[model samples]
Target: MKPTRCPWRGWLMLCLVWASGSASAALPIEHWTQPNGARVYLVRSDSLPMLDVQIDVDGGSRRDPPAQAGLAAATALLLTQGVQASPAGPALDENAVVEAWADLGAQFGASAGSDRLSIQLRTLTQPDVLDAAVALASRQLAAPAWADPVWARERARLTAAWREAQTRPDTWAGRRFADAVYRSHPYGQEARPETWAAIDTAALRDFYRRHARPCDARITLVGALDRASATRVVDRLLAGWANHGCTALPAVPEVAPLTRPERVQLPFAAAQAQVLVGQPGIARDDPDFLAILVGNHILGGGGFTSRLMQELREKRGLTYGVFSQFSPGRHAGAFSVSVQTRPDQADQAVELIHSELRRFVEQGPTEQELAEAQAALVNGFALRLDSNRKLLDNVAALAWHGLPLDYLDRWTAQVGAIDRDRIVRAWQRVLHPDRLVTVVVGATP
Candidate 1:
């Protein structure tokens, strides 16, 4: 007897296996604007019969009013909670909506990040399955119920979780850090229980209507579909998502830089102290992005070998681990170094961190350090695109940032070309050592 063939889920696994071997090579991105005004980016992969789609709009937390801090997040979440009845079908309660996707063996969900509200879908490319999945997703996107009871229940649950999280020291450190780093910017506006309570179904609907428009969508597709099939998929997915005549939203101002060093120390009953340091970093479109990325790897991003890790963890045994990263987004995002240590050692750890950062900003990385960071990044670049999902994410980011279509093709070259001078210049231009923000929670006051 012959072996049994795998089903849809198994086909996806097979696709990953097949794609992994070739993922290291550059994927050609096809671009076009749909008649409906949506921008679509495609990476066609015929390795298996599956499709992954991501749709992004400028409906993120940044669009939320400070008083309604989580309005965008709530809107995205409720999109799939229930969908209104339509000419094509009856209404779908949250449970029924979930079951419908299950029956089709497809997945669809929405989320809000700092700068984008995104809806994603994955389905087998069998003609009937793809069509049904697309149609269902279209309905959910176009006709969210914004039901009162559902929002109430979700809000209660979220509020409960938020309350619990507040009890933790790390949460306090993070929230306080964000406030100091962003000041009056929307990026600093974290949702509280009170903020969640302020958002109602009506607010959600209004936010969805204003921000989730076709003209603002950046859609990315990666799968076995050709350009024609992908176009059809997009059309069906956004069929009735008519444009609202590209009305410009009020311009969100850039994050304001700190005028001087700000320090916050909060007392708590815990054995470990949570320490966060650094300041506002670069935007995703910053010219020094690659240099900052590479330089950071040498300073703190790289594990074990990073200067921060070596100084704080290896040499002093201050903590188990310490890491730094730049959270680059649509606007300037935070660059932070975080570590946890004994409550008594909080001041020492912070001082050492500041000392290391100041030294790095002044002298930059050594020639050997730059070479190693570049080699590690270049050699490991293939892993970043070793699956369909990864490819979809990369393509989506490129589309969102208006980056060169060949960006991925030049990733390794760009990373390899970073010399000491470039890294030094980039770091010097971006980071300000004197104006760093330091926050310590659970420290001995």
Candidate 2:
């Protein structure tokens, strides 16, 4: 008897796999430009009665004007403090509004990063609450009061915080590492005591004017709402924003690799030393991004399975924990590994870290290691779309990175296709232990 070929069986298996994968795929992305010049990303889902909206403006710390180191950050913070014609009355009183939102089971906050300032809101998909939240956030973004007294108080608070950070070894090490790596670039400048003191209301307003133009912003909307209704809400909130044309961004300085290890010491009576090492890394849009990400996971990014953890913690017991990560921005960001250990073990820990980095560069992770990393990355991807808030974060990242609408759909396939050889090449190209700018505070060799 000869075995029979089952064509229908293969077809049925294919359909079943497709259906299972489709159920977890990201919602279709609809991109449109608002009349005011702000870009919007809308993803409609009826799975949950919640909505998440994020408005991103290209007005982060990098946009600060010369000699106004903290101006951009301060401007972003003040946007939520007070708006024109609001009950909070300039220097916007957030306590009352925050409490009110909490009562309504909603949340709102703002954050500023190296490349953008974002205002985010999450609320139940109820009409009245959503309408109010949208209106209030728009008003706050459009007409923030840069009052002198408010600016003065915030400056004092931020300055004190910076001063306090300077006294800590970990903070000092990170700051010095940034300074050494970026040199004269905007990334190098720290929010120092003098810089904070010089931040006045006029400076904040001027910085906002230069960077917070509608044309330079992008809005992302995700949640359980139809396109028509979401458009209406967005129009009501942001339609009034006027585009003042694009602002000229300063050219990013070319970063050079560090020549030797530099150390900064904080004279604190502590038993442990804080260390940060590595240098300027690839940009966000690099073609080898996925490969680098996977490689880093094997090197230091993955918790217990990574080379850094295995060598530093498991083998030598030099540090309780150690990890490395790549931070992507508009320009190239840092690749850093941070660790804390006893003062006497600092040099040994640093040596082990460098050794592992060099070994990974010379000979990458094994087939088993690469397969494990890929599996982890692929299997965990579904969690990214588990909620409206998480979905909105993914969309916001896509908008920020200028990725295509189909990025989410292709993500898993891309990760699956990455091979061990590609990861090895990416590791060698990006991770240079010898050229790293090392910062170790509170321990001496």
Model 2 over residues 188-270: C-alpha lDDT tens digits? 66777688777777777777766666776788887777778877777766654565566556676655656766555554456
Once superposed on the true structure, which residue ranges of model 1 sit more than 4 Å away at CA? 1-25
Compare the candidates by TM-score and give the number of the best one.
1
TM-score of each: 0.97, 0.88
lDDT of 1 by residue, 344-374 (tens): 8999999999999999999999999989999
Residue-level error in angstroms, candidate 2, position 117: 0.9
lDDT of 1 at 206: 88
Which stretches of candidate 2 lie above 4 Å from their native place?
1-24, 86-105, 259-268
Candidate 2 clashes between residue pairs 3 or more apart in a chain or in different chains: 81-92, 82-92
